[model samples]
Target: MSAFVHPDEIRSRFSAALSAMYRAEVPQYGELLALVSEVNSRVLKADPTGAERLAAAGELARLSEERHGAIRVGTADELATIARAFAVMGMAPVSYYNLAPAGVPVHSTAFRPVEPAALARNPFRVFCSLLRLELIEDEALRAEAAAALARRDIFTPCARTLIETAETAGGLDEDQADRFVSELLETFRWHAQATVSAQTYERLVAAHRLIADVVSFKGPHINHLTPRTLDIDAAQAAMPERGITPKETIEGPPARACPILLRQTSFKALEEAIAFPSGDAVVAGVHTARFGEIEQRGCALTPTGRALYDTALATRDFAALPDDWTALRRNGLAWFRYRATPQGLAARAETADLEDLIALGHVVAEPITYEDFLPVSAAGIFQSNLGAEARGTAYAVDPAKADFEQALGRLVLDEMALYQAEQDASVAATLKALGLTTATA
Candidate 1:
């Protein structure tokens, strides 16, 4: 019998295969390839071992090609439909992120399944969206859009069948998978036909073709197959050096190395020639679909760490930002106790807040990990890159809480009860397998 490939390996293969398919559909993905290579080289030089923790250097480079991609949808039905498509790519909806919380000024949710093993192999991820378009509207135009969406079927019969079969068996065979990809492309191509004008439609088609051909043909989009810079200010300043026009900067906190969770800004999407008007006609306009994005990464803090960070932000003077508040945190000394089990929480509860909390107090503060994304930052980048755009309503939403284990069970399609039983059995089996215990507990 074949050796049992670890779950990590399985996830790696899944990401790789899907990335290749996406590249085939989007062709102009060269920029992504180049950007990732640059980031990898820098990461290697800075800390080889650290970079290898989440992924090996070789895997990071490969996943860079498949990186991640973003998509926008209008409704729950559309969101669920796309979720089915992602399953074929071996992805699951792991976390629900509220875009509005990051100050994007809109109501949006992002789903990401960053499986540790898959990430280790190649951190390919997709950020798909379902916008609350109705809330912020031109009522008449929105009515028209709603009608159009109602009339359309986002997935074809073949695609739907493939999704259903795959959901049952966990995946598709080679032949069925190929057919599903072809049918999905065809469906999207058909949808592109509904743009404002033939020229607009053709432009959209070309853009999708570029993404499909350049990025996914080689595999599903690598974690995100695009240029990612650690320093946006420097990248923006240097854009003219590479003959690329720099877009406006999305302002962020001016800390030297703080992990500004998700501050993204991009150049306007430029135009390219596309055949339209039913004949071999050319359209002259820039496409704002592609843009440059940069991010600053920081320590991943525990929940306590995040809460502490928020409190600091609210209480600290704006001028001090992170610097001035260092003293306050140190003097107050309110840090997290790492082990968060019931016993741990109870033990740590005795030392509440900064004034009474101290390091020797047996409490270790978890680093404040980034929990918010700058949506305006994201949209600014999106808007900067595109020529034409649409507006949508924004609303405040109480964030939803997700228990991680439940997400994992859903992603793997295993019953929670079964998984727990298997885990128990495994523990006992390992003891016996190692001859540390008898068959009977």
Candidate 2:
């Protein structure tokens, strides 16, 4: 049996490998890192409190200095293949989210280590596979590409060997691990090099770039990663001073210290040069591919909090309400409430009424932690990083009816049953430790 890998160690190893993959694919990514460092420095020097909302300046220097990669696949089969490949790196599909019907173009998923500890250790991730709309005329291209992607397995025999060896061993011995990592990096580098002549490859690349050029992007090379920031207003104000012009901005609920889930705006994408078959040409362009996002994380609200969130979203009352997020934290009204102790006594000890709780010395409200990404914010970031403008939306799908579950099931090759079992076990362990009953009382 292979030795188990510590989750934190896995996080560290995976983050390094993924970052290398990104740099290899996007050389300009190095510039993005420098920009992030600059921004982090400025934010820390100016507003020390703001920096603490998510992480400390030094920690942000490490964790916040991350880049996420994005890709788009046409079908579930393609999605599955990519998922398996990422899994070899210790990633998993956490959420089933769809942005297809949203006004901005494209639909996709994010792959990463979902455990909160794993995220905290290193949240390096990819917003993998943004599927584009297939217009009637584009069906031929989509079909051919889909067929080709399904038939062609990107993970080679040797590549799979190294990956499986690494994964099953929970991580290779230092030398073997390093060798596998090298091989893995070489695989992606090889693709970027080998793609020169493959017609299928060219078609896919063109189609991928087309979405960036015409649909969602205004030009070419849309951003691969979009992050959620803690302060959109501050980030916006600070950008121009650093020579970055705000691409655009949007309104969210009146902000307070509490991190809102997602509010994003970014500086316009800078121009770049590309090589084409005809000749080398510089594309005078604007890219909506990169953006700055800020969020106020609320407590991991219980079902009640989610209901309140839904009510807030529906009424669009977050903006109109006089209650600041801090006020919510002060009161028991809008955050998650739970007992930290193993016994249920902590929950039971709280006074029943809010006023009574206040009088009875109960700590009714606690600030919710926000570490997860937001979808609307994600779509907004996607909109900002575009090479082309977004087409107007005609309709919104009832999420209940959307076939993303099955579609996604087809896209990933992992056994959901096994994944689910692992999740159940994790949950049961937590409940048992907390002295909660799993069976109906």
Candidate 3:
């Protein structure tokens, strides 16, 4: 039997290749990366404890490597094919995001590693959104978009074969994994030539810019690739100085001393020249879609905490909430992973009460970085990039997660449950490592 390459290794290699490809395709993205690196370095230097904390938590290694990309697919077949492709890289679809509620005609899910250890190794994710053709008001335009989507095969022939091989063989060897990454990369590469004619493209654009992006493209070219930043505010402030045009406002919570959930900001989408097929010649046109996004992630909140967060965010102010980590934990506004401290390891304590351990300086609790995206924030990014006209339109239809899942061909794993499980497991492991038991009888 051939030795199978670990999915984590395959994922890491694929992420590196994808980042390189994106940087080449979008030069501004390369600049954005440099700016983020500078900001992260400054943050680590200014707060040495932050560096130590990340290192101790096993996150330091992956900090510079972390990234998540977003793609929009036009059909259920494409969504299912992509899901199978992602599975070979150890990524599973988690959480359903209905962008229709925010006036974007798509529902989405993020494909990412679920295991804590897998995340620590390399937390690469892809936010996959399926274009909702039903939301299009023009039946003729919708039909045209559907017909256009039906004619294209997003996956390369080799990619499809490799996906099946991996499923049958249980895994791919190193050679096969390398080939798989290359095959998959082709599907995401940007095509300067549109598959649809200029007339068809204009019709799709009239329905929605995103609709055109999905139906007129050769494949789902990655619209944006996001790099994780330790200080999003600094990154935002630095964009203009670096010759990058940032969005008017950052998405998600206002600047908090202890950031909650995920905060994202991005440079304005670029207008790129493209060629649309005409009767016998190519028609020149400009397309605006790809952009560079930066994000700072904080703790994943519990359902109760998320409710409070939603309420607070709705008010458009974060000042009412406590800014300290301890206070936030006490108020049940965040989730954290616990670990035994030096003091805890030295002392023989038989207490599983998390608060008691923290109070006694036996266990140190760190916020489990939110490994997810917020739907509103995502829609905000989409609307901002799509322009004001797109923002003005509303999709009044109720969100249909069931329909989205059916299209995806599988139900998304609950993101909250994944976070809760990681937190619980960390607590259990910490107790075992410290040779301690819970306070409960």
Candidate 4:
């Protein structure tokens, strides 16, 4: 075995550090966290079965450990470097998302741990987006934007060095990992100085607020850091009381007894003062980018479930989905991880019918949590933070995954396929433990 800090441990440390930094930078974030924790406690208290189920499924311990931060880079080089940096933390790019059709000029991917054990340790994710300069309508502005992006290197020199060391020599020793995280944090740290002139910054903002946010900044400061909540609706209702101005509406699926996919809501982005270079004098300007978000995730859905989900979203009819979990399982619309219970371990089973085993209290199936983001919900959050001017010209409805993968230096893992594999493996393992040979799914 290699003598080095485990990636999961490194990831957990970094996640804690990052959250602390954000909490310090944005005080409201701490309030939101408190609100979420309070809401979760209430929900668990009200629903003892849910609390027990979550504890059994290993979700309760990691609730406070969950965090997803978002950042927007101005170029391809930044994307590749960030991917390598995330690799040190055991995060892999999962799924490509194109927000162009939603009028946001960026394509993105979520960098997160994939394995169940690794995720259970700390499911930290960074939703990284690369600015699509090609989508810029004005050729001259696009060229200028590209030039500004090319001039800046988001990764610190030491950070780059550590990434190389980890890649070439297997892994980073404890000291190297510590230094690596400290150096890499610079890339995501907030910068108050603009790379471009005041005039350029205003012009970019006029063209698209998101574009300006990406091109004007020295580095891609994490725009927002989200804390997971067990009850988002309660948290949303509670934000205003904390002096937090939430967006008008929540994004993603409407309320459901058994929530599916992701539901998100956020407070508005703050306008921070920034200095821009203008010849011999510095010009002062304000930028709106970073915000706070709270998300509640549900079970990962199958392809058929996703299709039904898409239709329901389009039609504004959530009734298409059954709110009951058993119906959801029976319909084969959701993915669940199966485990043999204590009684099952002590008894032999003749058949592998999953429902029968579950009915007999021999097997337990827990919903697999959705670890990724929804493009539409993501775009909604971006636009809400960007204000009325967020939407750009309607770009292609299709995703440019090829361009994203090329910049990432690797193909993104399919979220659905990962869920499918996890579910299948769990079922197999559960059946084997019960001494059943027949396939249940």
TM-score of each prediction: 0.58, 0.65, 0.97, 0.98
lDDT of 1: 0.42
Native-referenced Cα lDDT, model 2: 0.47
Candidate 2: list runs displaced more than 4 Å: 1-4, 20-68, 88-90, 130-137, 147-158, 166-172, 179-222, 226-230, 250-254, 270-272, 275-316, 319-368, 393-403, 410-441
| RMSD of each predicted structure | 10.1, 7.2, 1.4, 1.3
Regions of candidate 4 where Cα sits further than 4 Å from its true position = 391-393
- Clashes (backbone N, CA, C under 3 Å), per candidate, total 60, 26, 2, 0
lDDT of each: 0.42, 0.47, 0.90, 0.90
Residues 1-441, candidate 3: write the lDDT tens digits. 779999999999999999999999999999999999999999999999989988998878889999999999999999999999999999999999989978799999999999989999999999999999998888888888888889899889999999999999999998999999999999999998998988888888888888889989889999999998999988999999989999988899878778788999999999999998887888999998999999998878889888877888898665657789998778777788888899999898867777888889998888888999999999999998988788878788887889888988899999999988887888888898788655421
Question: Which should have the higher lDDT, number 2 or number 4?
Answer: 4
Worst 10-residue lDDT window for candidate 3 reads 432-441
Give a tens-digit lDDT track for model 2, residues 1-441. Answer: 445454446446655665655555555444445555555567667887655633531235444644455555545555565566566556676554556555543555667765544555665566654454453136766666444444444444655676666556656555555555555443333221121223443454345443433222111122454443444566556666666566566534445445444444555654443322222432232222333333323333333444565578778776433246545543434433222232333445432333343344432223434333455666655555553444344225444213544556644323233333433453344344444545210
Per-residue error for 82 in candidate 3, Å, reads 0.5
lDDT of 1 by residue, 1-441 (tens): 223333333335544554454445444334433544565567557876655632422334443433445655544565666677665665566444445443232233344334433444544455554444433334654454455455556667888897787677666665666666666554333111222334333432333322221111111112222344554565555555545555656444444444434444444443433322344553333222434344543333334443555555556534433432244234332221121223333453443332233333422233222222334445544434433322232345554323222322343232223223433454344333333332221
Candidate 4 has its poorest 10 consecutive residues by lDDT at 388-397
